[model samples]
Target: MPVRFGRIAARMFLPKKHNPRLAVLLMIVATAFIAATTLFAKALGGDTLGPPLHPFQISHGRFVFAFIAIASAVAATRPQLTRPHWGLHFARTFFGWGGVTLMFASVAFIPLADATAIVFLNPVFGMILAIPLLGEKVGRIRWSAAAIALTGALLLLRPTPESFQIASLLALAAAMIMGVEIIFIKKLSGREAPIQVLLINNFLGVLIASVAVLAVWQMPTAAQWAVLIALGICMALAQACFVNAMARADASFVAPFSYGTLIFATLYDIAFFAQIPDWITLTGAGIILSGGLLLAWREARLRQLP
Candidate 1:
């Protein structure tokens, strides 16, 4: 029954033909949705919305509502699905949930722009992890990119004793865990339908978060509840758009546009939170984005070679 539902959803949502222009548009939209999730997370993590929710509780809400959203789509479309690789799904969900929880933890103490910039380090971490886990070779160009991105992350850390923020470490840790999640995502990429993967991943995330959040469970204020739902729906939409974009165009083409998330995150911070980034935040984000773009170009070049 579930498998049949997933197939219908995939047909309904997946692009029928390649559309590079549409793909770029979708990537941009996905970035906005992704950034919106963080904005909601920041709101729920802080006292302005209500009593601050613990990171676990925030993440739990993310999974629960996201699952509901995805499940509803599955039922509506009724797509058929292949059996999932449960082990891979479990590992992916574990790291994904952990990364989001840590990211939420950091936003409570730091600006959204700063936190979003640091999270970009995930691709670099994924590159490093690929070396050991996937037996993939990393050449000097990729290494250089990693170095540049790390330098940007360090600048964001504001290592000076007076200005240093301990909460930033949580964001750093989130990037590392999310990097591992990327590795799993790569493994699953060609193995299952994107809709199926998303459904199972969210389902597993809900189970894990439900267990972890039990210890820190607290009732959220009405506003927090609304923000949580918005966060989840935004995330579900982001995932759907991102997968569809990748299907429509080369990842190298679509991936760079994803940096749009940083821009949107900053704008949201300014519009709602009135947080203006200093030169450091702007410069660090640019440096990191440059490194990420360099790496993407390198991958494109490599793909062309063969």
Candidate 2:
């Protein structure tokens, strides 16, 4: 099922009206679902649920069930679709799959708070990537914001020899790869229906993840299976909410609110695993959030200019 080209195109490309209030609400909801997805991933990644699932297996389950969820939505809505841009879909799916796998891997070895905070660097990486990929110019304010965010990531890394976490590197790499995915996503945005994009992206993701997971795949216990399903459904919901939120309002208006994921993830960590955020986690996360908000403010300001 696909959405009508005319209606979706108009909403995506035409700046008819914007509802920042609704967008913020949707974004916050999306953050909760996203945090829940990671919480489930953490459960499956560690021994709490069962034998720790491989990152490949965890990500594969994510795509499989997420595709199932989106497919069900498409079946219900039955929107007419436009011709898809396959190249962009493949690029987006490839990086997205890789990023999520690495992210799952990272959370297994580090606190959810640190992993979530470090992955927040995706926006900064996206800004750097846009310079070459999208031919966007970055001024001093944007550069400073990126630097501040990166500094926060470094603090989370605990540069001291004894305290440093090797796993954080996985989260860093995930952020970079997801940043590249953002370039492809930006290319697709406004050119396709959000539902169609969701459908195709998840379909391709499942295929890619299935192939990769085969090498290390193992059977998940009953509890692990349930969490896997929950993880995928949450991811599907998160993607839908995020895309619809962007469709409703300016991204800069909605982007900063995505930081709600960090809050939710921290709370989940504490509630489920008693993993409290240390001073470094809280301080670094705050720094990263400040930089993200700064960048969002800069973007909003630039858009207002002629």
Candidate 3:
């Protein structure tokens, strides 16, 4: 297992070539794995399993298992996560952990589709963050796109009697943090290997979750144990596939497939929770995606500039 994982890590760090078709295929599949990870997490925390776990405990277990997998991979491959960026790494992981903390809890309260869609607004947040973080310029068109995206979020947030959910708010909060986290990743990906970044991210998650999880931890039953393990495995695979996909393609090329998360989330919701998003959610999600696509087009154009 260690040897096999080592090879995976090695490939992650030093890809000789980029394959667009393969990258897209891998990303599409990775999104499905990510969707499965969320499903497992929701099951671990939901009433369907009886005696819901604490969000921190779930995070703790996730990082713990992910660490085991990643460590084993690195142990054999020996990818050194050395040479600086300590502050940025810490900042990125801090926000990344916060997103995990909130998103996990939010799933307990909201439908999967709504939570995932709210989180999907990360690109818009990324555009906003890029000015300071990446020194990237956004023209009027992109800023206008942001306004339309905000309107979409507001529409989803309309306080209808049966449709409004506080959990959706939590998810949005997580999504915003995730946006900042992605900006950090954009910086890091240029300087560090994917394995190194993932290792540090999970390592910090373990340390933070260990302390937080203690206050609310509960012993996992056998079935929950299996699901949690599956969650770890699924997430590790998803992360690996995602990093590889991004490494092989430009952000604009990969951005659209990221929306596959919505389809997978909706499918899982129907299969497990028997829920479907209402018109408001669909409409709002459409608007948000429109803005995100616009942002991607703008980014591609910027990259093409001489």
Off by over 4 Å in 1: 1-12
- Expressed as tens digits, the lDDT of each residue in 15-106 for candidate 1 is 45888998999899999999898888888888898898999998898898878878877777767899888999999999999999999899
Error of 2 at 71 (Å): 0.7
Per-residue lDDT tens digits for candidate 2, residues 145-222, read 999999999999999989999999999999999999999988997898788898899999999999999899989999
Candidate 3 residue lDDT tens string, 1-306:
656765665565556367888789889988998888778778888867768998888878788878777776778777666675877888888888888778888887777777777787777888899899799888998998788778788887767887677777888898899899988877776787778878888888788889888889888988888788777767777888888888788767886888888789889999988888788878988888788777778878888889
Question: Each model's C-alpha lDDT?
Answer: 0.89, 0.88, 0.80
Cα error of candidate 2 at position 90, Å: 0.3
CA-RMSD of model 2: 4.0
Q: Give the residue spans of candidate 3 off by over 4 A.
A: 1-16, 132-135
- Residue 64 in candidate 2 has what lDDT? 95
> TM-scores for all candidates?
0.95, 0.92, 0.92
Best by TM-score: 1
Q: Give the per-residue Cα lDDT of candidate 1 at 221.
A: 92
